[model samples]
Target: MKRTTLALLGLVSLAACAQAPQGAAADAAGSQAATAQAPAPAPKAAPRPDTPEGRALAALRELDPNIEPDRLRAAPIPGFREAIVSGQTLYVSDDGRYVFIPGVNGALFDIRQQKNLSEASLASLRRELLQEIPKSERIVFAPPDPKYTVTVFTDVECGYCRKLHQEIAEYNRQGIAIEYLAFPRMGLGSEDYRKMVAVWCAPDRRRALTDAKNDRPVPVRECKTTVNQQYALGQRVGLTGTPMILAPDGTQLGGYVPPRQLRERLDKLAQGGAGAGAP
Candidate 1:
């Protein structure tokens, strides 16, 4: 959930914040202040296209076309959508005049709201695009001519991710080819980030990655790598942790799923049985 302030900030009425003048002077000042009327709120901003509301909505539509204007309504903030395009509740200004998109982490915002609406947006966006899959990033890790491929957004240092790595053979035994993409999780500054870049860019990425996962020492060589792109992909999908599974068809399964379950679900997705779980 995001809370946006729609009211014009500079136009706050004086009646809301006058302090007492203190003592006898304070008494007289209070009486004078009380007699003075507060200024009226400023006229709403001109809507663009039609008025402020239209402009604000146009801006939102620029983000995506699925926005239903009829579905648009006054938010707690007034002008913003009572809920944004993704059904994520957001606040808009009261006058259908202005809009703000708030940033939040956990439960600290003024409004109490469920988390990951932003994450959900990323998933929705991915669903609408990112359809063609790439091959260079994939490696056949399984037997019997693998029937499923899973794109894993992984960080080498992540614990559960390490656990998943340990089971790569098991997953393959079930005919799931594990394709890996780097999501360093610590951003690009960390050592793991650099190493993963070397792994992805290595002449034999499969060997480099497998060796790295098995704790084998690899000569670190770096070129411009897909590490950044992969991390961006992960973030755009709201990946807060590692070992995110992107099924062959792009449905996302976060965290760790056991090999048996992973194989079954992969088969299901391959057969067109999964929903839009991608992010």
Candidate 2:
């Protein structure tokens, strides 16, 4: 599995101040002074329909009509606008001349905050997208009172994935809900994909999932399931491996985390502290 990189630039606002004349110049400059003092015309409002944003959105739709343009807005970068298309964050040059996809090796950082601006934006977009997923499609293991929910993309055949599943009870006990989304690392048309479909088709999905993770036979079954859709979603979010944990705020934990440690990290996130662990 390969990880993708995304880049973002910082935003800075510039303000200009006009100084009024003083003393003799002040008296002679009365009329001119009023002109100078007159507040600069209110900064132009963001262009509306048929404007740059509209043009950019139209151009994008020409390529893919499914791309939602209503969310298009000026990005922190001066000449670009940000938009979410199919749950992925995309940057379009204001003139509709360029489109930036997440995952560039080099990234722009905020010197003052020492944070990766691009990743931060991507995280926000991911959180928003995840929230839109209906809970019915996910196989969730949650306590009655969950303090935080972590979404995980898992593959039955992956060793680390099984390890994480084995500890699901401990995670729930810690008040951390684990919502599972299938990611057949082997891709479609493989045994892993078939098994996932079977697990989802079972009458008792939770039991079937645990049994499969334990390497037990998951009586082959077939049904209309969102396994494939979930796989596509994982890719859209740049998933690189199984057992990929997504924190409540959309920060990726990268790999398997021990139950207790994972709980501590969730606590910090709940308290509005910086996320711990790597992407």
Candidate 3:
């Protein structure tokens, strides 16, 4: 699927989620704290139904009745509102007559700031979503006190994914931590997904992942896994291929860049400058 298509699916998924009952309960202590503080201050009033946010939210509900109201907000562009559905960024007209995605017609650039406004929004969304993945759920390779960390959505059967694994030490040496999440290019029920499940379930996940990437046999193992969740996450972040590398702040640094080149790009980002060229 194309990135745009995956992004649309992400929004659809959010609508779907709203119709389903929540699987986890709110923390008791957290709920109590909220309740205790409720009487101290007046609750903010809901937006008027005629307001921009309200109109946008209403229009979104026409698309899917379950879109959470909290996801809608004023957009950077005047006369529009932005909705964060799942991890996708969508812009809705204030009148609620239209919706648009960044990079649909052309790049949405902020000339004064010299930045791609759409990409910036998407990057922030990606970063926030990625940070929510628990450390234990990722297979990581890193140097002590790494200077930077990147999350990579990978398929064990992908050639470039294997190539990147071969140079894992170099990435670590460059003080770049690599966090791996499964994104089996083959669908969920494919052999590739099963192999990834084994890798994640292994006693030594790091080694097992490397072994799978190297085409070595991994003993079939089954346990509760996050492979499916991570794959769905990949789609939400506009992933269209394996080995999609994302910087700490959610900028896509692209696929399988050599360690030195990858480090150079990261260094530029660290120094608050755009990289030499698109990754």
Quick one: best lDDT, which candidate?
3
lDDT, each prediction: 0.59, 0.73, 0.78
The sequence of per-residue lDDT tens digits that candidate 3 reaches over residues 129-206 is: 897679999999999999999999999999999999999999999999999999999989899899999999999999
For each candidate in turn, the TM-score is 0.52, 0.61, 0.62
Superposing all C-alpha atoms, what RMSD in Å does each candidate have to the true structure?
13.6, 18.1, 17.5
lDDT of 1 at 23: 93
Q: Please give the range of 10 consecutive residues that has the lowest summed lDDT in model 1.
A: 1-10
So what's the TM-score on candidate 2?
0.61
Q: Which sequence of candidate numbers ranks them by lDDT, best first? A: 3, 2, 1
Compute the lDDT of residue 133 as modeled in candidate 3. Answer: 78
Writing each residue's lDDT as its tens digit, candidate 1 over 1-279 gives 121111111111222355545796767776886657767666544345655456556544433344443345555543445534333433444333333444432111121122224434454576543443356654435557887777787777788888998888898888788777788877887888887987877888878877777778778896866577777777775566788887644457557888888876666556544222321
Which regions of candidate 2 deviate over 4 angstroms?
1-107, 275-279
Which tens-of-lDDT digit does each residue in 1-279 have in candidate 2? 011211122111011122445775667666785677777655434446567687667545544554454467888878887876544566766666555655543333432243455556767887887765689989999999998889999998999999988888999898899999999999998999999999999999999999998889999998998888889888877687788899877877657998888988777656654435343
**By lDDT, is 1 or 3 better?**
3
2 or 3, which is superior by lDDT?
A: 3
What lDDT, from 0 to 1, does candidate 2 have?
0.73
Sort the predicted structures by TM-score, highest score first.
3, 2, 1
